[model samples]
Target chain A: MARLVTLVESGGPGVREVASALAPYAGHAQVIGLTGSPGVGKSTTTTALVAAYRREGKKVGVLAIDPSSPFSGGAILGDRIRMQEHATDPGVYIRSMSSRGHLGGLSATTPQAVRVLDGVGCDVILVETVGVGQAEVDIASLADTTLVLLAPGMGDGIQAVKAGILEIADVFVINKADRDGADHTLRDIRSMMALVTREPNEWRQPIVKTVAHKTEGLEELLEAIGKHHSWLAEHGELQRRRTARASAEITAIALGLLRARLDVTDELASAVAAGEMDPYAAADRLLG
Target chain B: MARLVTLVESGGPGVREVASALAPYAGHAQVIGLTGSPGVGKSTTTTALVAAYRREGKKVGVLAIDPSSPFSGGAILGDRIRMQEHATDPGVYIRSMSSRGHLGGLSATTPQAVRVLDGVGCDVILVETVGVGQAEVDIASLADTTLVLLAPGMGDGIQAVKAGILEIADVFVINKADRDGADHTLRDIRSMMALVTREPNEWRQPIVKTVAHKTEGLEELLEAIGKHHSWLAEHGELQRRRTARASAEITAIALGLLRARLDVTDELASAVAAGEMDPYAAADRLLG
Candidate 1:
């Protein structure tokens, strides 16, 4: 399993070989994305969710992508320490991916890693990311069920709304529910949802309140996730979402390869800089 | 000026024509990028800087890119209101670009808009953005001088360090300098900067403190920007930076056009799903 993940991360020729071998076994596991701002207890909620899934006698895998602290990898280390409860559980697998400053690299590599886990007999895969930036939002395209976690008194309601997190959330988990203003946060999300005019047949995103540190509300959150999964399957949205994911994954890879192929000549760049050629014309020439 | 900006933002076929026509008149403006977290008074600082530049009898253009509030365009509205001092000035042009949920689209469109501003007899161009994500970081490539603003008590020091904002900031502004912990924030940034190992000949990044709301320290901030501009020109870094920007812009455009051309078929995606083909192989087939 470690070797397969390494293959995917390396993004080398081996990725193709490993992916082809695992392709047949993929799509069996339910992929869930869990994301929220920092200090929102995403790690605690993820650990709770993993334990709950394991209670059902199912294998689980986690792919934690941390864009923060690329130099120290501190956040991922803290997460591993906190998740040690599952360290001895053979049914659980965990991996952490840190950003290496390559543009679009994380989004390109994550789906392949998830595919590997799916192929390796994990009954469930949870992709946990800090929902702070564009790369994190890209996870929405990959997961069958996306859970946007929010916490009370964090000013998260406004931040989440501003960041457009409301659009991607299938289940909104207001963690730290026991904290003051949790109900206010819940109301904020509900009011925001009320603003959207959805078709009657459309799935209404459910808000699940959780004090994740105490493991309270785990079952309800899980139930919401399960319900969303079922709704997706019933509406054939599962296939549509997966198809879109595959399309994006393929396009990202193709573009990465094309980038590797086309080296912008210094002369061309100098021409553009010298104001003798426009960037659009330069792009056209380079593409040719 | 507004029509040219519209043409660039539209990304229509006429963009190339407009770009080529304006190419000869470009490369004259000194583009400065100012970015920081929300509530850091970026608008206030931007307004002050525009006023300062105008006092020097120079034409200025401001492009405020807002990733948040794309739907309502509220940030731009706020900026216009704050910058109403220059509303009647024919020498100053202000435009706002909102994120339309397209990946790398802002980075793709911004340089064209900057080119338009540069073409239209603007001596100074200010590109203001919320320093939150990858698109904001990409602004470093487009600007001659990048100023990262941080306010006291904002926890921006740690956020800046985590986001690797240190590398991109050509100048750091400790805005709201009269607030408590202003010195602490300045010390934090200074300490962080002290850890960096720079060559003797390299231009060190300067930190400027400003009470932008009071219009204090505006001249010093402007002086820092001028110093950076002069340093860039003397070191030939200006040409080098523009060359790098053109390269990235060209690559992004080429990749975008390629994405439009490659259609991922359902059969191809299903083949990958069924383990009949790897994604790399699938991409190859699609490219072929």
Candidate 2:
């Protein structure tokens, strides 16, 4: 599994072949994505969740996507330290993925990683990432169910972070529930949700509170996720989501193939470089 | 000029016409990009630099890229407050571009913005961006010379921000140098530069300290930029960089065209979405 994931990480014809071989056995695992701002106990919550799933006698896979920013530490070891309790558990698989710098927004091969874990014996895969903004949105697009985590005493920080993340979250988990101002944060989220207009039959994103370090409220969190899963199946939303996800996969793959076909020869590039021809004109010639 | 930039921002056939119309007169302007972490006096320094250049009766264009991250305030008004000195000058054109979220790193149309500025008779175009991650690196690739700003007493924050930025920076401007530990920051940059092996004739990245608010050391900064520009010309690096930049532009254009050629019928997407066929196979059908 690790070897296949490494191939997916490197990403080329080999990974494509691996993906093709695995496609027959894939699409069985539940893909759950967790995202939140730094200092919100995301890693702790991910570790606790892994234990919860493993207790059910099911295999679990954790893909911790370390932020690609230079400001972030090389934190693969740090994540291992936190997940040490699951170190010896054969039922749990944890991997930290980091992007090559300047590759643009989150790694392109993340969906492939999830596909790899699904094709293995894992029944549940948790895709956890750090930071808000575009990264969180991308996570939501890739996951079967997306959980957006927050904590108390963040004050206006919560207000700031909630802007674009409100729609993409499937479950809202206010971690560190024992901390001060937990009630205030809950009230703020309630008010914000009130502002969002939703259809009467739409799935209302439930808010759950937990102190993830102590594994408090693990049962309640599991109940919320299970209810969401059932709701997805009943409303035919599961198939819709899978179809949308597959469409995105197909589109991304098509774009890659198109990029490979771009015929920017040295002579054309040199002409644009020399200002003797503009890029649009040069591209025109190359395309012809 | 504003209309053309708008067309470029929309990114389609209109921009193609606009670019082709302007390409004949482009390639004369010097594109200088400034990037740094927030609060490093980037805007103030840019304001000061604009005034200094305007003193020589040169037309200048400032393109301030408001970061796409949710954490940043919508600061187009803030940037304008600092550059109000140039507000009345017809020769100075300043535009603040805020990107649509999840649109990816920086903006794909940034080069087209530069092309518009150059064709409109701007002698020097300043592309300014905030943040210390992939955004900074993208700015460096788009500009002839990239300036990285640092403030005194940023402490470990300075250490963290300098990782990927050091190699791309053609000039290091230590803004807020009036504060304490200015010399300390200067030394850190010098030692860091020392670690990078360079040929004897290679242009050394010069460190210039400035209290941007007070407009101290403006002449030295300009001189350093002038020297770097001269060195780039003498070494034939300018042509090489432009060719690489044009190659990227041409490839981006070609990709856009190839994407239009993809024949993803609803049946193919439906097959992948329904799980009857995998995405890679669907992509192959679309490409066929």
Candidate 3:
């Protein structure tokens, strides 16, 4: 499993071979994406959810995408401490990935990693990301079920809406539910949801409240996720979402390869910099 | 000016015309990028900088990229209110752009807009972004000078370092200098900078303190920017940076066009989804 993940991350010729070999066994596992702002207890919630899934005798895999650097050691350490409960469970597999200074590396490597986990016979895969940037939104495209977590006093509702997080959330988890103004956060989300027009037959997102550190509301959160999965299967949205994900993955890989193949000459760059060549014309030359 | 911005935003045939027409006149303006986390008073600093530049009798243009949605109207309103001082000045042009759900859209259109401003003979161009994600880092590539702002209690130093903001920042500003712990923030950044190795003759990054709301430290910030600009010029780094920027811009445009041209068939998507076609092979097929 570690070797397969290394292959995917390397983005070498081995990736194609590994992906092809795993392709047949993929799509069996349910992929769930959990995203929320920092300090919202995403790690705690993720730990709780993993346990809840384990209680049902399901094998689970986790991929935590950490955007922070190793130098900022506290947050990553906290994640490890929260997730250590599952360390001895053979049914659970967990991995953390750092961005490694590449802007879109998380989006580029995550799908292949998920495919490897799926092929390895995980009953469910939870992909967790800090809800900050485009990378978090990319997780929505990859997941069959996406949970957007929020908490009172996180100043997240309007900010989340502005970031377009509301559109991607299938289940809105208001974590830290015991906090003051948790109800206000819940109401804020519901009213925001009301602003979004959806067809009558479309799935209405459910709000699940959780005090994740206390392991509260884990069952309902799991149930909401299960319900969303069932809805996707019933409406054929599962196939549609997977197809779109595949399309995006293929395009990203193709573009990366093309960029590598395209020899961007210093001469061309200098000419453009000197204003002797237009960028469009230079682009044409590069394409040729 | 508005029409040119619209044309660039449209990403139509007219973009090439606009870009080519402006290409020759570009490189004269000192493009400065100001980035920091939200509530760090990026807008306040930008307003102060604009006023300082205007006092220098330099024509200035501001491109404020708001990744948030228009529905979250308060933040945008705050930007407008802060920048209202320059609303009637013909020498100053300020425009706010939202991400509109397009990843890297700011990177895509910002250069063209800057070119338009440069063509009109602006002496300086200020690009302000909420220093959150990859997009803000992309601003570094496009700017001649990059200023990173931090507040006393913003918890930004470590986060900024993790985001790779420290590497890109040419000038570090500890804003809200009158606030408690401002000196600690300044000391923290200085200590962090101490860790990065640089050549003896390399331009050392300067830490500037500013209470932007009071318009204090404006002169020193402007002077630091001027010093960086001069250093880039003297060291021949200016041409090198622009060449890289143009190269990236051209490549991004070329790849965007290629993606548009690549015909993604539902059959290919389904085959990949079904595990019959490997994504790399599918990418090659789409390319062919």
Candidate 4:
């Protein structure tokens, strides 16, 4: 909208341009996060969503977060290899990023990466994090609407242990619906959701069952996302959530960089070498 | 043991004395990290190891890192709960820490927690990380030896995508040995191990088979850990690894604290409100 595409393509620039350029439609686009255990057909679900959105003439962006190779500091970069069918479509943009050895969550570049897609004029950004159970819930903090995808037969308490993810879902998608125990997963999620009380103004968490690979329930999934987004907007909760996420953005960036700096300090080196310090001590000293 | 029990009581304060007290057997105690996907019986394997170690008259300490509840900032603490049988034993000590939203792998207090145990005169400190997958590989840098546990049927190539975990494994344990596809998993690991050229003086990654809960094949597992220790010492790799991990401990500590800080920022609140930021952005901005 602001000739932002040209500015962003100019080598390297501040992210503010990207953020501000994309700010106008920030509320218009439906940004949904999809996360679940590995082998849960997350990719298939994403593909169907892309097709569904495009069928409606809506532009979409898919930011797939893959696991990074610790040795090379690059993403395993396999998801793209398989999802090349949409590579030539102008209405869709797919970008892959390595979680970059980030143990507890997604990479530091994820937000700016999402902003890049936003600046590119996507009406929807489907951010997918790697399958790491609860820790992968980091996506919920950034997404306007968060969806936790689960397959059938993931076991009872296993879902409960994912406190990291359970607390954040606006919608729970029981994907691979054709599989056995899909209903059980749905019921389990509903039971879990029932235990979690939404904020006074927040919408009730919805559970939808879908066979993502077949596009069996893409319409219902889309509807659920739409319902959640609109609910937030009507209650003005959308604006409140996004602002809090932005401030979190500043703190996350500040800490990530500072941590990288402290990771390479001389004192830390001497301490480890002398056997006089541990990570816990180094943390205190580094923060101090 | 330098009255190391007092240090464990004070938590953080006991790290120095514990490290010093453990220094005498630092070379002898083999700190092995066990991690893998959920349902892989990491706790069962840890339990089996403790039993085996105790039978040999060796004291073992287990530091089980569980996913913490964001609301209460406390662990659901499932690992230890499942490990109740060992709770009443005098020779075995178990401590649990919640991720408490620390994204660099373990919680801010984890390293200190590990140190507290190290000082308590335990011969071995077994750290069980919340194994959602590769993101939890930070344990490799914490333990002197690391075992990346995998199950039989995670689908082909799933492990290949796990570059982070694979690179860090001093040993690989394919647990649930009696499962139908156990052989395939064993072969997969061996083949993957073959892909990398072993370091000149370091030990090759060994894949061991075990059914942990049944206490089956644990002797071989302990043998592997012991052999790995001997290999490290014989090759000077143990000291080298410890030195490296020590430095990582400091850096990860700094990052852990920073992560903790960002987790609670007003900015996060704003971003969540505005829908402009997600946790990935929050975490990234915190890092940046």
Highest lDDT, which number? 1
lDDT (10s digit) by residue, model 3, range B152-185: 9777432344446677799999899999989888
Which TM-score does chain B of candidate 2 obtain? Answer: 0.88
- Judge candidate 3 at residue B179 and give its lDDT: 93
- In the order shown, the candidates' DockQ scores are 0.44, 0.37, 0.45, 0.34
TM-score on B-chain, cand. 1: 0.93
Q: Which stretches of candidate 2 lie over 4 Å from their true place?
A: A37-41, A66-88, A100-103, A130-134, A149-163, A173-195, A207-224, B38-41, B66-89, B98-103, B132-134, B150-163, B174-195, B214-220, B263-267, B273-276
For every model in order, the fraction of real contacts preserved is 0.48, 0.41, 0.41, 0.37
TM-score of 3: 0.93
Say which prediction, candidate 2 or candidate 4, comes out ahead on lDDT: 2
i-RMS values of the candidates, in order?
A: 3.4, 4.7, 3.8, 5.8
What TM-score would chain B receive for each of the candidates shown? 0.93, 0.88, 0.93, 0.77
What is candidate 1's CA lDDT for residue A62? Answer: 91
Considering only N, C-alpha and C atoms within 3 Å, which residue pairs clash in candidate 3?
Answer: none
The Cα error of candidate 1 at residue A37, in Å, is: 3.1
lDDT per residue for candidate 2 within B61-147, as digits (tens), equals: 998876433434333366777788899999899887653333345536677788899988999999898753456666777889999
Lowest summed lDDT across 10 adjacent residues in model 4 chain A is found at A2-11
- Candidate 1 lDDT over residue span B167-217, tens digit each: 888999999999998999889888888888999989888889999989898
Model 4 misplaced regions, further than 4 Å: A1-28, A68-78, A101-104, A131-135, A157-160, A197-200, A263-288, B1-29, B67-78, B133-135, B157-160, B255-288
Instruction: Give one digit per residue, the lDDT tens place, for model 1 in A1-288.
Output: 978997787787667778777888878999999888767998899899899999999999998887654433333366777789998899999887764433442566788888899999999999988775554567788899999988888864223455467778999999999999999989989888888999999999999999998999888998999999999999999988887787777777777777789889999988988899998888899888
List ranges where model 3 is wrong by over 4 Å.
A68-78, A99-106, A156-163, B68-78, B100-105, B156-163
